[model samples]
Target: MKKLAIFLFASLLGATAQAAEYVIDTKGAHAFIQFRIKHLGYSWLYGRFDDFNGSFQYDESKPEASSINVNIDVNSLDSNHAERDKHLRGEDFLFVEKYPTATFKSTSYEPAGDGKGKLTGDLTLRGVTKPITIDVTHVGGGKDPWGGFRQGFTGSTEFKLKDFGIDYDLGPASQTVEMILDVEGIRK
Candidate 1:
């Protein structure tokens, strides 16, 4: 009976040392999902998805255990131009009516020095799932004035539009798209 009690106590201590999970704070207005793609090989066109929600598990003590998942509303894309936004949501691009959401699920996290890391995940876009890697930088984490614990991170990745079946060719400008994510999470 004494041995059993000691084993249970050890198990509890180990669990307490594990990572904590956090839910993405959608209401904070600090989280953003932005994109930039070349236009006509002359300039870059910028856009953002206004609606997204996600959660992450983070362990400062063991950063490799950290993982994240996010879902973005395709129809919420905004490019600052109504016409362009509409076109982007149409069949020529996202086809939001048929495939309304894009998602990312982290498979691995490799921490780099100075609060940076490479996060590799499976990205599902336009009904296709492909692996992608994002360079991540931990912005910071702390307690908020509202008495909530918060953490923030920034990540960026680039991919070809055609890789996810977005094959609309707008000349040289249609090849690649750069995606950036500024995410904040609240401890649950």
Candidate 2:
């Protein structure tokens, strides 16, 4: 009788549970979008976007019910140098004047076990839309002062620059670019 009573209570708790809400912290968050390719086959050069914003809806019980939305300012591209940043904003690469923002929205998510999962989404950059998959892991979750709850998540994804209409010829040294995103956002 005791075992049956415990089981009934557990089922009631599960049925009444709801997913939590997390607020994304833009100030504390970091979005590192980077890429590189062959530059005359000599060495690989890298660059990144310095500013961006986004948020996500995460429900561990329902992985497929999750989603993410992110927007990146194309003009914020920085290659650690002024000249390169200017060139990247021009018609050759991102064409910041034409398309001011790059965005991504997740279509679905699936847990791969051990707090890791796959997030597939449509990424739009420089007027080109492509499907991208990101490997994500839960960094941590907790509450801060001021009665606010937060969760941190980090994800990484890589793709060819040419596939996104970024066909700038950087010589034979760089042919493909590997992009990485080290993001930490509060769930809201």
Candidate 3:
């Protein structure tokens, strides 16, 4: 009987020490995935994926064990211009009809210091999967007035357009695109 009690206590402790699961607060519009690319080697074109959802696992005790997964609706991209947005969705660029979705699944996290880290993942875009790294920073965390605990993070990265099978080149200066992501997760 004593051994059984001790085993149960140890199991409870182990469960408490494990990572916390969180759902990205997309319904509140508190998260974003934005991007920018040079336009014709002269100006910049900025846009964002307006529809995306994801979840994450995090633990204060073992930050390196964190993980995140996101799915993006490629057709939901908005650049604030109608004609250009349509063109971007066509075969020359994203080809949204054939590839309507994109995704990112984090494989590892490396803490750098000062609440910042390197998040490496496999990004699947345009039916191509490639490894990418995002420089991430822990924005903040706390309990909200709605009686929910939340944590936020911001990340940025840049990759060559050709790397993701996007070969529609405007010019040499427009070979790469920069991406920025912000997420706020509510503990579940």
* Candidate 1 all-Cα RMSD: 2.9
Estimate, for each residue in 1-188, the C-alpha lDDT of model 2 and write its tens digit. 99999999998676435455444465763446666655677776778777788777766666566778888888988778799789879998889999999999899888888878999999999999999999888777666675766666777777777899887777654556666666655545
The clash tally of candidate 3 reads: 0
TM-score of each: 0.91, 0.79, 0.91
Poorly placed runs, candidate 3 (over 4 Å)? 1-17
Prediction 3 TM-score vs. true: 0.91
Query: What's each prediction's clash count?
Result: 0, 15, 0
Task: Estimate, for each residue in 56-170, the C-alpha lDDT of model 1 and write its tens digit.
Answer: 9898888888999999999999999999999999988999999999999999999998999999999999999999999999999999999988889999999999998888988
Clashing pairs for model 1 are none
Candidate 2 lowest-lDDT run of ten: 15-24
Which candidate, 1 or 2, has the higher TM-score? 1
Over 4 Å off, model 2: 1-17, 29-31, 36-43
Q: RMSD for each model, in Å, please?
A: 2.9, 5.9, 3.5
Whole-structure CA lDDT of model 1: 0.93
